[model samples]
Structures are given as C-alpha cells and as structure tokens.
Target: MADIRIVDVSLRDGNQSLWGAVGLNSAQIFQIAPVMERVGFCALDFSSSTHMGMAVRTDHEDPWERLRVTHQLMPNTPLQFIGTGLRFISWESQHPEFMQLAYDRLVANGIGRFVVLDPMHDEQAIMETARMFRQAGCKEIIGALVYTVSAVHDDAYYADLAGKMAASPNIDRVYIKDPSGLLTPHRARTLIPAIRARLAGKALELHSHCTIGLAPLTYMDAAELGVDVLQVACGPLANGSSLPSAERVIANLRELGHKVDIDDRALRQVCDYFTRLAKVEGRPAGKPQDYDASFLRHQVAGGVMSTTRRQLSELHLEHRFDEVMAEVTRVRAELGYPIMVTPFPQMVCTQALYNVIGDERYSNVADQLIRYALGRFGRPTTPIDPDVLDRILSRPRAAELMHEAEALPLKEMRKKFSPKLSDEEFILRATMPADQVDAMCKKGASKRHYNPEAAGLVKLLKALGERPRQSRVFIQQPGLTLDIRSAAKEAN
Candidate 1:
C-alpha cells in the first residue's frame, strides 16, 4: 500500500472558501467531525487563525468550540488543525503575541499537528515561521507556499521555488499551494515529481483547487510522483470552489493499483452531510464546473463572480440580469479581460437571457455570450428567440418554483435532515425498534430520515449502538401504517 495521508480541509478550507459569508457554526462542525474521523481522515484542518483578524465570535467563526465538542464526541480520534502565518499580528494589538498565542491555544486544546501557510507578501518568511512553530513545540509542520503558481512565471521558477522549500531547515513538509486551481494535471504530473525529486527524504505535498476541474487528476499524478499528502474537500465542497474529494481520489488510486488507507465509508458520510449543507445554504452542490482556460484564469486572478452574484441578489439585481451581463461583456471588452466558458458564466448568461424578450436571435445571443466570454469570438453576433424570451419574462413565481424543485432523490435526501430528536430519541428511531416508528416521528424524527431501506435503518441503528429487533421491516411508500404495538413488543 502506498503511504498517503488524508488531510480533510472541509471545516477550514472548504468552509472558508465557499461559506465565507455565513461562516460555519459550531453545531455544523460538531455534526461533521465524527463523520470525518469515522471515515479515517488523517487530520482535520479544523479552523484557520485568520478568524482572529475578522471580527466574528469564536462560536460563529472559529471552529475551536466545535473541535472541542468533536473531541468530546469522538475521543479516540487524533485531531489535527492548521494556522496560516501570512497575516501579520498587529504589534499594537491587545494580545501582543497573537500568532504564538493562537498556536499555543490550538496545541493545548488537542490539535496534534499544524500547517503553516505563508502570506503572498514574502516567501522566505516561511523559514522564520517554521522556526517559530518549532520553538512553540509545534510538531509535524507542513511548510506551505501559498499562491506561488499565480505568479507570472515559467516551470523553472516553480521548480526553483520547490528546491528552496526543500532546503529550508525549519520546514518539515514542503507543499505546493495552488491557492488558485491553475495547475493542470499534466503540469501537476510533471511539476510534482520535480519537487518530489528535490525533496527525496522530506515530505512533499500538493494542494490544488477544483476551480479548473483538474484537482482529482492532479492528486492522482501527485500520488504517482510519490507525493506525501494531498488536500481534499468532502461532498459539495469537493468541486467548483472546493478541493478535490479525498474519497474519489483514494478510490481511483486504489483501483489503479496504488493503495491509500482512508476510510471510504466515512468519506461518503461526510460528503452526504456537506451536500445537504450546501442545499440548505442555497449553493450548487457536487463536482465543480468543467475545467477550461477561462475558469483557470478566473481562479488564478481571484475572481469574485460567485460572491458577486450574491451581492447582486442582495441588491435586488434580478430585474437587471440582462443589463448586468451586458456590463460584464462591456467591462471585459474594455479591459481585455478573459472570461472562461465555465458553468458560472453560462449560468449568468442564462439569467441574462431569461430576462431579455426572447427572439429566435436570443439563442445566438447566448451562444455569442459564451464565445465572447471564452475569448473565441471573431465576430460574435446576437441571436434571439421570442417564445423562449416570452416564457421566461411572462413566467410568474418562476424563481420560487425553481427553488423548490432542487431536491435530491429520497435515498440521497435522507442524509442531511437531523430529525429533531433528542440524541436519545434519534438512537431509538434509528435502531428500528419497530414499534418506535410513530413515536420516533412524533419525538422529532426528521421527515428526511424516513428511509424504506431496512438495511440502512439497521446500519444506522448499529452505529448508534442499538441492535435491530424483529420489527425491522421495509415499508413501501404510501402503503401500510407501521405496526407500533408489535414493534414495541419485539423491542421489549
């Protein structure tokens, strides 16, 4: 089995990357930690130190409380956390040694490992940061080079940077941080090995984003090149704006004859949880937009279209969707900016096209929107479709209908809704005490958890430390009422 460590950044990177606006709550992190541990992740990038700079409560933003809660819930699993060294701790601050203080607190609170990502301001500062971590008794340091790939440079520059990272005595592991998902798989396959060769005895890691849809392949190539660790995101956090999924990569790698010792079951459970979470958050879930040149540039340049859409919505810009797209086109043209043919632009154009009075020419308009956005248009012309535009414009309550229609299949839907059950009640319902069905629903069984699969019911029951009783029966939908008396009797 090839030695591969799974470091799940769902709580830290995943949350910050996607849910930065709302920030993750302690409740959500508490719900996810055991699932991550159960899935056999080597570490959790629990929370970032960056939260201190942002004005938010620890409960609202910092994941420390959740990490502590998870420790209480699953005491057996070792917890690992991360801190970035990029932001400067204010010298005039109330707490003078903020960085060291944050570092000490995490270590004191059971975080066994740490990752130090340097700021874009300075590269060599990583050496000093690592030394400070070592002085503070930090073990297992991952010396991360952040946003290095975004620099206008050639392959040789990247190779030389890797070599500098390897030669740093303060660092334990050297990681190539694609703060933007710009590294193509072919690039990763070539570059990761070059870095690995430079750091023959030291740990080499790769961190890529799914913004360009190349993260999974990059992970595979990293594995092939003897990379030590690969950062991953679980569930909906796995693509578009998140990292490649650890579960998918491990499965693919194992199939290809290399071994990675991550727990597949845990990964799936975590993914299920996050997918549900994303739906609740009103963001698109699952694998990200397809990779292309435009998307890569967007990610590299720190584009804000995803965030921009939210801002536009808050300002009630839906009525001006077409105008907004026209503005997008105008700005791009004026600055010679590149827009990729990614799903986001398509979605934006769709919204714009939806608002315009559709003529047959509108289809061509949409096509041209895509072509021009991708920098491929020689003479992009507008096309329109009258009926299509009429259907879009005349439709009443279209947004509401669209929102309600985004549900997943029942089988998949059961994962996220926590039946309002008290912890005890959840155990009883999940255990399938047969007679407990009505009581379970009445006691707060979330509507989403009512599965027809007796097997899943049994597994869940077992996970909750309950043994199945004879009342474990598969009830077909819209059929027989659950027999409570008989099931209760069996349970007793």
Candidate 2:
C-alpha cells in the first residue's frame, strides 16, 4: 500500500463553493480550529486576499488577527493561501513592492504555502510570483495550472506547461487546479502521467472540484498513478460543488490498498461538527450530485455559480439564467476562451448579463472586460474573435487603458500613503479602500464564540436575547406558535 497525504480545503475553496466565499466567519473558523488540527491534515487551505477583503468589508474582522489566532491553534499544520499573481486583493493592479509586502506579511503572519496562478497560463507571471514568494520567506510555492477545456488546451499543451513550471527553481510544488471540475477520469489517466514524467520527482497535488460529479473518479485515477497529495474537504463541506469528502476518500484509498495517515475518529468528529453547523446556519450540506452537461457549455466555476445565482435572484432575473449562460458561452468564445476561474468568469458573466438585459448587443461593457481586451490581464489562450475584438478596443476606456503608465514603485507609494504604518496595515490600505480599513480597525475582532454543536433554535434564541429593550418576540411556523413578553415589561 502506498502512503498518501491530504490537504484540507474546507475553510477556503469549500466555503467559497458552498457559501459564496462569505459563509464562514472568523468566529466560526476559530471554533473548528482544534478539531481541524487534530484531523492530521498536511496543510490547511486557510485564507486568501479575497477572504481578507470579505472579513473586513462584511464582518469588520481583522484578518491579521484571524491568522494569528489560527496559527495559535494549528501550530503544526502549514496554512496555505491563493493569489492571482498580480493583485493582492483588489481587481486592479498594484505596485510590485506592494505585492511583495503583501507576500511578506502573509508569511510573517503564518501562511507557509502559496498556490499562485495566472489564468492566462502566462509562464513569466507564474515565475515572477514564485520568485516573490521565495523572497518573502514562504516555505512552499506551488505553481498552479488552471485547467479548462479549449481547442488550444490539449493534454500535450498542459504537459508542456506543467513541465516548464516543474523545472522552475523557485517553485517547490506543482498542482493541477481544476476549479470548474471539468477534468474527467479518462483525461486524468492520460494527463497526470504526462505531467508527472517531467516533474523530476517534485511533489504533485491534484485539486479538483465536484461540480460535474467526476472528481472522486478523477482523484482515484490520480492516486493510482502516484500523485503525492489529494486536496479534499471534510464531509459536511464536501461534495456538491466542492471537493469530495476526506473521510470517504480515505476509506476508498484504504479499500484500494493505500496507506492513509489520517485519524478517522477525529475526521468523523470534524464532519459531525460541520453537519450541525450547516443545520444551524440553514446552509446546504455538500452531497453527491448527478453530472450536469450544461456545465461544460458555460464552464462557470462551482463557487462562482452559487454567488451568481444569488445575485441574479436578488435582481429578479433568475428566470433569465439559461439565457445568461448561453450568452456566457458566446462571450467567452469572443473574448478568447479564458479559463472560467476567479475574475475572468466574473468578467465574462458580468458582460453576458449586460448583453442579455440590454436593449442591444454590446450596449454595456464592463471595465474589466475592456481591461482584458486591452491586454492588462494577459494575452488570451486563443485569438479573440476579430470583429468582437475590434468593437471592444474601439471603446473609450480601451484607449485610456492602453495609455496607462506602469505601476509606481513601492517607495513612491509609501510617500503617497504613510510609511509609519506596519507592513500589514500598508498592504491593506494599498489594496483596499481607506474607509474600509479604518472601519475594521475601529470595530476590532468579534467576541462571539461560535459553538458548532449549538442547535439552530438555541442559536436563534441567543441572538434574539442579545438585543436591548426588546419587549416581546413572536414566532410562527408550521403547526407552531409562541409569544413571550419581557419580564420587566410584563411587571411594569
């Protein structure tokens, strides 16, 4: 039996897919830290710049303090982060010095591993990011190949690309990142070996989603072919659009004569905790799903799909989902078939939504699309449609974007801002708005303790009781009704 390692993604990608990336608060994460530490994961997919932004914007939580707390609890496991290789957290570009500072601060704050990716498959971009990560003292820099299905993205293409990345001195590991869950078992059988042949014995990990219900099969194939690590989520947060269940993966690996090192009892306890938390929060638990063929057409990432659905529903445009998806296919083709991952899928989906709802085609173009067309993001995998490219380039923003100067140096940026600020504060101020940072600094960390085993009713009651001057409360549900007046008010 061969030994295998696991990287847990329940806090990062799993939450992104199952809860729109805004689901788990710092308090909730703190509650599960001990159990997660006991589960014996080799690494924890803990945070990202986007997560930092969400923490500050939504919950006013201090992201740095969250990292400190996590490190305090899970000292043995390495915390991993994801980045776009350009921006720290914002969509716009930042100075190279600013990005370096962000990386340094991440390493200083306990992030030991970084999974850096460039959606356009730009080799230089990956190398530069890897170099910066090494300079920042990160222990591991994992170069990611964002997987997608396109005419130009065949197995040979990926093999060559993975080979180059594997050969880079700055990269400590390489992982096939299938964010959209488009990789099938047959493709894995062929692609994994081709990439492995060029690795020169470097560690290769497989990170795939369950969006199309083939990740389990794909994982099995990769393990059989001798991949080093398998990225998975715990049970309640696994399956659905997330990765397959870790416990299930371990059981399957054992059945297949592989030596798994995880603690099954601790794994079950973590799973049971999340199961209750999902119930209390009214969140959907991850479950196995049948394959959906339409996923190939849109190629929208599992995480983005849930968030997009919610946004459209809020605007009463849920009925136009199919139309928007169809438009995504057309727009993606016109824009050169960029992988449907972070920022790109968002840009494509926004443009498609505008096209579908507008009075005429190309009536509304998002700035990000114009930036993409102007070559700010990077070159496309394939040539964009000529006419569409011309139309996009003809926009006023395109000309402005074309003439924009290079990003400023770190020293000049510090002159503009305050050099007295700590590296963490400076990175936050550089990437995010000043007002948001100030608000987060003022509010401080949340004091709530999120008990995973608390019942939904108990949580609800506790929340209601915390409000001041609440005279009475009423609730009505199917065959249940209750009203309670405040004791002080009743006595008065």
Candidate 3:
C-alpha cells in the first residue's frame, strides 16, 4: 500500500478556522518553520487571498515577505495557495488579465500548488481558471469539490465533477473539500469510491473540518477507500472547527495498516510549540465537539462562523447569535443554497445578520446579495425565491448594478494607480483600503523569532520600563531575571 501523504494546514485553514486568521504572525511561523520542514509534510497549506489579507490588515505584516521567507526556510515542501474563483483580496470578480497577474506573482513569490475552489461548482469556470493558473507557472492545479448536504448535492454529483476535473489537462489533482465538516462516514463509503473511480490515475485528497465531529471517522473511511492524501492541522489548532490533529490521524492511519511515514519527534515538537504559544497568546484552543445536527442547516464554515461572532461582539449584539444562525438557514434557502464556501458563506451570513437586526427583513440587503441577483457571480443552482429575487431587483441600486460592465480592462484599471508600484502592491491597493496597505509597507520586516514563555514577562517588564521617571527596574523569576534601564537613565 502506498503511504498517504499529509498536507499541514495549521497556518492557513486552521488559523482561519479557530483564530479568524489572526493567530499566527511571522515570528511564530518562522520559529516552527525549520521543524515543520523536517516533519516530511507533502506541502504546507500556507496562504489564500483572505489569509494574506488578514496578515496585512491585522498584523501589519507584508504577506509577500512571509511567503518568500517560509519557502526559503522550508525548501522541500510545496506551499499551497487556495484560489477562491477569479477574485483577489476583494470578493467581487476581477478581469481575467487582472487575476492572471495575481497568479503570476503568486508563483513568483513561491506558491507551488494552486487550489481552485469555485463555490458554485461551475465546472467550465474551474477548468478555465485551471488553464489560466497552469499558464501562470503554478506547479500544480488542484480542483475542489466543495461539500454541502443539499438535496442536489449527492454522491453522483461529485463523481461527475471529479471526472470532469480528471479529464482536464490543466488540473493535476482533485480534492473533496468539506468546509462545513458535514461529510459523514456513511457518505464517504459511497462518495469516495465514486469520485476515485472517475479520477483515473490522478491523486485525490480529502479536506474536511471537525465541526460536526464526523471528519475523523470519514478520514479513516476515505483512506480505506483509496484517498491519496489527508489534510490535517497541528496541536492546539486541531479539532473544533479545524481539521483533525496530525498526530492522532497519523497514529490511526498506521493502526489501520496504512503506511504514513512522518517524523514522530518533529511532530511532537510542533504540537508542544503550538500548545505553549496558545497559552502565551491566550488564543482559544480548538476542542473536539459532539456531533450537532443543526450545523447541517446553516452550513456556515468554521472560519466564517468565528468572523461573524467577532463582528457581532464588536456591535454588542453577540447574544443574538442563535437568531443570526436561524436567519442564515432561511437566507440560504431563499438564495438557493449556494454551496457554503468562501464568498457564498460570507455573503449568506451577511444577509442573514442584516435580516436579523434590521427593522424590516431584506430592507438592508448587502451589495453582494444584490450582485448575486444581478448575476455578477455564476448563476445559482436552484432558482432563487421569486419573492426574494423580486424584492432585491426592485431596489433602485440593483437596477444600476445590473448595467455595470465586467471589471474594467487590466490596462485601463492600472492607469488608476501609480506606475512605480509592483503588481503585488498594486493588487492589494486596488482591492483593499490604501491606508491599510501603506501601514503594512511602513511596518517594515516582521520579527523572525518568538519564545512563548518569555513573551508575557517581556511585555510586562517593557510596560513597567515605560513608567515616567523610572530609572531602572529589576524582576526575577524561578529561572530568569530581567533588568531594564531607560535610555535617559543610561545616558545620565
């Protein structure tokens, strides 16, 4: 039996799932890079446009530098970048020329594999994008069959898409992506074989969340059914909404008589470091949960759920979370249940929140919702509710959006920015607020090393040193001592 390769997603998907993509900074990642490199992962689920944006917006770290440095540190493992359709940092679609440049720069910076996730499962669109990415020098193109439990999404549905992707010259692999963690062992019994039979000789990967508590079992079933690889996260980042723990998954696969060749010592080091860092940073550790059937209805992804919670807490309406989720289910149905992936999950959740809080339902429809009705994205699978569609189109702004042309040509849009800017900075500037990008550039290089145990004491002593007229301060611990002196006092 061939050994099942592992792809570590702790930096990208796991961070996004549990920490809303703000947990790991460059220093934290760099400290673990050398060990992670030695652990023999087939690849690192390193970055996506949303994850990259989080680095810039939250940490004020230059995302490009993080990619380049990580690749330098881990020269052997491929770095995977998930492409959410044809967009960049923004949710809105961009012109082909614009997106091509984005892919070109990603390859240049060190992204080795491209995962194309079209939320709607538009086969033609995925193939077209795969072709473009292949031309952009992407080392591999992996197609995603985003899993959801809709009436129309059955085993055969996925099998057909897998066959289509396998036949495409541009797409090198196919993966079943269960962002909501809804795939069950029973489903896998039929789904995995159906897809594998159609994949010809190409490799198949399985990526599912731990949200509903079914993924761990499903993963075992998948391996038994010929899944080529299993995606996992490390230590504290594992479980809850994130993927399965790498250590546990490897152990189970081996017990099942499947060869999973990984360095146990290095894996233990990864778990220890992240567990310590989680304590130091006071970030929430993902805990395995009992299966909850309610999750199948809303189908909001773990990352999107955390983000929605944070947004609600910021507005002092966190207590109404149940109401928002209830509305999410309703809104999803009205919107024809667009698969719960990337922009669709985000869009559905936003509208649900608005409807929950607004005085009138659908009174304050989000532009994304309006754009969907305007056919800005691919058409919805089932027809949207006539009443909901009518209400959206009746709005005055919808009429104007209906006439909006495809994204301005790349050359014409480039004229809007400075000629001196690189493609990377230009893309960020065009999509995100200019001030955020400026702040990212101004922050310079990020710190490259972190000692979790010292983090708290260092921060506290630094705060104490900043006290007015404090000439010197001394602190002692069981094994460490620190003496701080102000610059003025030293000069004196």
Predicted candidate 3 versus true structure: per-residue lDDT over 176-289, tens digit per residue? 999889999998999999999999899999999999899999999899899999999999999998999999999999998899989999999999999999998899898997
- Model 2: C-alpha RMSD to truth? 4.0
Q: Pick the candidate with the highest TM-score.
A: 3
Q: What is the number of residue pairs that collide in model 2? A: 0
- Find the 10 residues in a row with the least total lDDT in model 2: 447-456
Best by lDDT: 3
Candidate 3: TM-score? Answer: 0.91
Candidate 1 vs candidate 2: the TM-score winner is: 2
Candidate 1, residues 1-492: lDDT per residue as tens digits? 467877777777777666662445555666666667677666676654443222122232223444456677666555655554523222111221434544565665566666665332235456656666776676677766543332334465556666776777766777777766777767776776666676748887777777767777777777777887788888766666678876777788788778677777767777877776665545555456575775443332234554455556876765654355565443332323322223234444444444343343233334333333332222211222334434433444433333333223323333443656443223223223334344423443111121224434455445544544445544445654443334576667
Per-residue lDDT, model 2, residue 272, is 85
lDDT of 2 by residue, 130-232 (tens): 9999999998889897899876788888889888988888998899999888999988988999888888889899999998899998988889997989999
lDDT of each: 0.54, 0.86, 0.90
Indicate the residue-level lDDT of 465 in model 2: 89
Clashes per candidate, residues 3 or more apart or on different chains: 20, 0, 0
lDDT of 1: 0.54
True lDDT of residue 469, candidate 1: 46
